[model samples]
Target: MQNFDYMTPTRLIFGKESIVKLPEVMRSLGKRVLLTYGGGSIKKIGLYDRVNELLKDFEIFELPGIQPNPKYDPSVLDGVRMCKENQIDVILAVGGGSVLDCSKAIAAGAKYDGDPWDLITYKVKAQAALPIVDVLTLAATGSEYDCGGVISRTETNDKVGYMDPLLFPVCSILDPVYTFTVSKKQTAAGCADAMNHTIEQYFVADSTLLNDGFCESMLKSLMVNATKCIENPEDYTARAEMMLCCTYGCNGILSLGNSYSGWPCHGIEHALSAYYDITHGEGLAIITPRWMRHILNEKTIDRFVKYGINVFGIDATLPKQEIAEKAIDATYAFFESINIPMHLREVGIDESRIDEMAHHIAVNEGLENAYAPLTEEDIKKILIESL
Candidate 1:
């Protein structure tokens, strides 16, 4: 096992009535609340009215329309302005991970005197941040439980995953009931996102059996429950389990004592999503198997063999190479089965900028030092193969 230190201070209030505690939770943090959200899904789901009723005593200011791939320009900038102007006490992030992510950036940016981009890019470390309390409505990204958030600077075509302990939500209300209405496409994409989170950590160079088992079981649960969710979106039991799995996905609990895999898949997919504004999870699903095929070799065959046997239950007696290849195929088939676009073109991404994206990823993502190190040419080949 690799040496490591871990801490998760976010208090999780899970289950049906979790949101009822929102008022009390925010009470300790502040009276002036910055309510952040994406689109108007909360209103459609009645969560908007419910939250307004619950926190009626507090002064609330709104920052709406935080998009997926959470942009830094307007959302983060506007949020910071709102916080500073209103002297916001705490942020109440509604909607999904993108809202929470933008809120995180706003939280940190609210306290920093420099450009918020400075803090996000690590040009300056955040000394303090506005407290955040989230009511999670999506099961993807795990931003509800993790301190890190991916923020994009669209002008630069950069999506940076920023992490500072100060950015962790003080409290997260995870009421699975709220997720029962999530659409079928989002449900599958969410499962793909969480599955990739586990796979990134599981594929590391050094890991314990305990962590591996945690990942394997979570992947199995996500697959089974995702199928259930697609068939019946209102299946409370499936939604609850999948929600919990995603909540744990990026919080480091699943990868404790595991060597860093450099999260190569995420590294590559970040560029794809940043440049194309594609669905983050769908981009990952499209790139993952191709990355797997490109990286498979004698040095990494053992992990693939174990993944194939333990997770997918491939015949143990098969040759290691065959097992690895089958494992990759099984991964591809699973995403296809879930109805995610398996090819880049299917998602409206084409080869026009493949070379540009490859070079950009090579320079910015630092994937040259990944678990299965990839060069610029290697990345280009993978992108081409993905197409």
Candidate 2:
């Protein structure tokens, strides 16, 4: 096992009726609140009214309409302006990962004088940030439990993953009830996103048996529960378990004491989503099997064999190479079974920008050092295969 240090200070209030405790948790952080969310889904679900009623005693400033992929422009910039102008002491992010992600950047930007992009790109270290509290409505991204987010700059075609210890939410309120109304499309996409998160951590060169077991179990749980969620969105047990798996997905718990795999799929998908504005998880689903095929070789056969046998229950007596190839096929089949568009062309992403995207990912994502190193040509091939 690799030497490591870990700390998770985010207090989790999980289960039914957890949102009722939001008022008490928010008081400890501050009385002045900046409420952030995406489109009016929270309102449609009555969570918007409920949150307002709970925080009625506190001063509230609202920043709504934060989009998927979490734009760095108006959302982050406006959030920072709101925090500064209102003297907001804390942020209450009330939607999915994108809302919390935008809130995280805003929290840090509120305390910085220069452009927030500097802090996001690590050009400047953040000295302080307004605290954050979150109510998770989507079972994806794990932003509530981790101090990192992916922010997109539409103009620049850049989607950067930003992490800072200061951005971890002080508290996260999770209730499976809030997710009952999520569309099947998003539910499946969430499953794909969380599954990829575990796969990224599991495929590393060096890892502990304990961490490997954790990753395998997480992948199975996501697949099982996501299927249930698609069939019956109101299945509490399914939603709850799926929600917990995603919450743990990107929080470092699954990767601790393991060597980094460089998260090359995410590196590749970032460019796809940045250029074409595709759904994040759907892009991952489309690219992962292709990347798997491209990187499979004598060096990686063992890892894939184990993944096939353990996670998918493929017969262990099969030849190692066959098991690996079957495992990759099974992965593609799962995403397709869940009705994820499974192809770049299906998602309206043609080959027009494949070269540009491959070059961008090679230059910006540092995938050359990934577990299975991907060069510009290698990435281009993967992109072509994805199409």
Candidate 3:
């Protein structure tokens, strides 16, 4: 086990119609607000109107069209400006993880004088931020319960993960029914994202039995319910469990008191998404199995063996190396079985940026201390093999 300090301050109200309490939550944060969302999905599903109706008593300022891999330009910059200009008291993110992510930055940026990127890049820690409240519409990213969000810079092709204790939502309302329209592809990708979150923690060199069981249970739940969610989008039980799994995915609960693995998949996929702007989770799915195979060693094989036998039920009698290899195969096959494209080419990532991405990871993501300690050359090889 590793030495650690942990805290999650976000209050979760989960269930059907939990969103009806939106106004009450907002009331605590004051009146003027910035309503943030992505490109019109909420409108299509009548959530836009419902939110407008619910906030009829409070002043509303709209910030629309936030994109996935949420950009820092219009969403964060514009939202920060809006909050400052309108005297906005509370920030409500009304879309998936991307929108909520953008809003979290905006909530902090509104209070800062310098560029928000300074806070995001860790040039300065965010000490104070406007309170954030969320009505989650997707079962991915777990941005609601976490203080970290990934923001993209189109100008530089950089996607940076920003974390601050001040950025945790004051309250999050999770209604599983809101995710009923999530496409099968997104559902699978979302589950993959959460599962990868667990695997990242599970692979650590320093770990505890408590966290290991938490990660394994989360992995099993996501793998089992993700298919049910895809096959029947309206299945409330599957949707509820999967949503909760994702909400708990990345907030350090599954990794509490655990040593870091340096999150090697993230170290690689951040380059892929930052370079080509591919979907974050799918990029992770593509690189994960390749990473596992590349990093297999006696030092780490025992973890893979445990994962194989415990999570996937591979026979414990198998040889250690074969068991580890089988675990990697099962991982790739699970993503394939869910119909996710398991290669870079399938997701419009071409060869021109391989060197560029490798260099970026070398300079930006710091892969030197990864679970397997990948250098730029090793990263290039992993990318090539994944390709």
Estimate every model's Cα lDDT from 0 to 1.
0.94, 0.96, 0.91
Poorest lDDT segment (10 consecutive residues) of candidate 2: 271-280
**Which stretches of model 1 miss by more than 4 angstroms?**
none
Cα lDDT of model 1 by residue, 284-372, tens digit: 99989999999999899999999999999999999999999999999999999999998999988899999999999999888888899
Model 2 local distance difference test score: 0.96
Tens-digit lDDT track of model 3 for 288-382:
99989988888889999999999999999989999999999999999999999998999998788899888899888877987779899989989
How big is the positional error of residue 313 in model 2, measured in Å on the Cα after superposition?
0.3
Clashes of each: 0, 0, 0
TM-score of 1: 0.99
TM-score each candidate: 0.99, 0.99, 0.99
- Candidate 2 Cα RMSD (Å): 0.5
lDDT ranking from best candidate downward: 2, 1, 3
Cα misplacement distance, residue 7 of candidate 2 (Å): 0.8
Ranking by TM-score: 2, 1, 3
As for TM-score, the candidate ahead, 2 or 3, is 2
Candidate 3 segments whose C-alpha is farther than 4 A from its true place: none
**Cα RMSDs, all models:** 0.7, 0.5, 0.8
